[model samples]
Target: MSLYRPHKKGTTPSGYRGTVVARERDFTAPTVQLLNPAGVLRPTPEAEPYLPLVEALPDTTLEQFYRDMAISRRIDIAGANLQRQGQLALWVPSHGQEAAQVGSARAARAQDHIFPSYREHIVGMIRGLDPVNILSLLRGATLGGWNPAENGNFHLYTLVLASQTLHATGYAMGIQFDGSVGTGDPETDAAVLVYYGDGSTSQGDANEALVFASSYQTPQVFFIQNNQWAISVPVSRQSRSPLSLRGSGFGMPGVRIDGNDVLVSYAVTRQSLEEARSGAGPSLIEAVTYRMGAHTTADDPTKYRTDAEVAYWAERDPITRYRTWLEGRGASPAFFDEVDAEAADVAADLRRRALSLTAPTREKIFAHVYSEPHPLMAEELAWLDAYESGFEGGAA
Candidate 1:
């Protein structure tokens, strides 16, 4: 029998049992969309001012956007496969949210800092992180861990939901304290961009971060990728109000955008970060998008959502819609073909590398416990060694 099936009647309210999706509230926030579902280059009225930003982009940069999305999907696929094949402990797929990740990631200036809630693999890769590091983490082989300074200021992922909001806010405050923001010099000025999910909005840490971020007028942008469902729970069940309003509630401007539209994501984030770095204070952006896959390798989305809903989103796949726009731009078939070939290569290489990663040593766990060595850690390591040495032919 299948482990996860749709709920019939008379079951409990939870995954693997039954669900009661009380969509008592619906969010109908107006969103800025530069590209429609048909891949047309028409912008909504709200997106008019930002049209020039997209137009001003060189063809090469535009092409890079598509490349990044394509490659991210390939790597995401590889991650899922690795998890299923028992090569990875778990996998968090960013399957359907490519445009939002790519566009927003590209919008940040080199001087800015970013904090990602796990699942933003592409965002880290864009900030000069090797995808192998991500795979290594999943493969249970990370030792010292990645350094943000060496990786374009992209901080490591915080697995705790909504915790990164505070981390990002704290960093922004540090930037302010150092007089790195509002200096009127774009090159020297910096800001913070933090990514969180729709569900995280309900977390106390997220709201508290907002409180501090707004009160201090921190140089930061709160980018909420509202992908409809926060894990298996719908956003409507959590809040009747539009998430964009969250900005206004916190004394900041809130803007909603079509997260699937790369143009909208890039233009709006670029403008928000600019204003932030220039000392205009913080802002909130609600990127309305969807996660077309299971929440994680362990999840079964089919158990909670319907087939029709999946079909509807599949029609609006970010990669497919973006490719349509690129085609309208007269991109050659060879360019697309080359991208596909490269994506295939990337996926294959990731699988090969992921399999090669060895497990981390026990000593590595104690190494990062503190900046300076601790006597307790040394004693514990010795105890662990003696305990393991009791086993036959053990290195301990």
Candidate 2:
């Protein structure tokens, strides 16, 4: 019998003796897709409404989108190389999840806010964040590169896993209170897109964020990148069902997309964000992708995973797949070559900037500790100066 077949009620199977094997029901989830891995346009009937949005995107813009993924991947690879060479303090590789990050980020409007986990550098890049600024955060030069208020509403990368989910929900609630959404003007209305990983789904904060989002019907989208492995633990260890199903339990619609397929990711995120901005409640999107490299520079995948697994994911590299799709769609070879060159140039510049970064001075840390200066901060600075003066160099 098939493992997924239903068991008869009150009847035991031959292998179980007296116990019965529970039925495995198929998942009934709504996934809005526009493109498959082979670059074919086989959209579902439900996805038809969003075709105009997809077709409206210019070919030049699509080429740029390809460039974004390519450059981001190059930067990620360089960062990994730096980590291996003992330059960076730590590096989180978003190797195989570029399509999900880049596509979803591009789908958001300028007014929308984004809350990201630490590995969303690609999203930050799409929001016009300086590459060097992002490096400063990884190198421990600053808490985060730019203020959210001035950086296209993109919040700082939260290292505490799913903590950003609550932050996003709170921001969404504030948006509702301020009457910034459901204004019928897509350009002016605001929404929230918060990103997390499969590992963070197990956190209490993530669950609570979903609860509050549902209760208030906030205009937000919870973007979960289910990269198969949460550090050393496989996703199977976290839950038996897909992560998107968690949204159903919270009374919200959920979607699953091929995260490695950039077109699908962009199309689905665009639809979801538009729905949220147009008075719909929160939605959860689970992007099924993989992390082809180690979780972080400090991690050793060899200890917990097999080489065959890494090689398996490598074959499905997001950048490569997207490039193949673009090429198949009559994209010129010259365009591909130009993008490759541009990516290389960007990587070179980033490497130079990272290597030439200067460490902040002693007083620099105290500059932004508080908006207004306080006596306690003055006292602390004075003490730090005295403590440093006691060293052999008598300087910090």
- Highest TM-score: give the candidate number: 1
**Residue 21 of model 1, lDDT score:** 75
Q: Which residue runs does candidate 1 get wrong by more than 4 Å?
A: 1-28
Backbone clashes in candidate 2 total: 0
lDDT of 2: 0.86
* lDDT tens digits, residue span 1-396, model 1: 977776657664363565567865654667899999899989999999999999999999999999999999999889999999998888999988999999999999999999998889999989999888888877778732599999989898888899999999999999999999988997999999999999999999999999999999999999999888877899887678889989998899999999999989999999999999999999999998899998989999888899999899888888899999999989999999999999999889878877887777889867868999899999999999899899999885
**Tens digits of lDDT, candidate 2, 113-174:** 99999888889888878778878888888887888877778899899989999999999999
Give the lDDT of residue 396 in candidate 2.
Answer: 57
Where is model 2 poorest over a 10-residue stretch in terms of lDDT? 11-20
Q: Candidate 1's error at 212, in angstroms?
A: 0.6
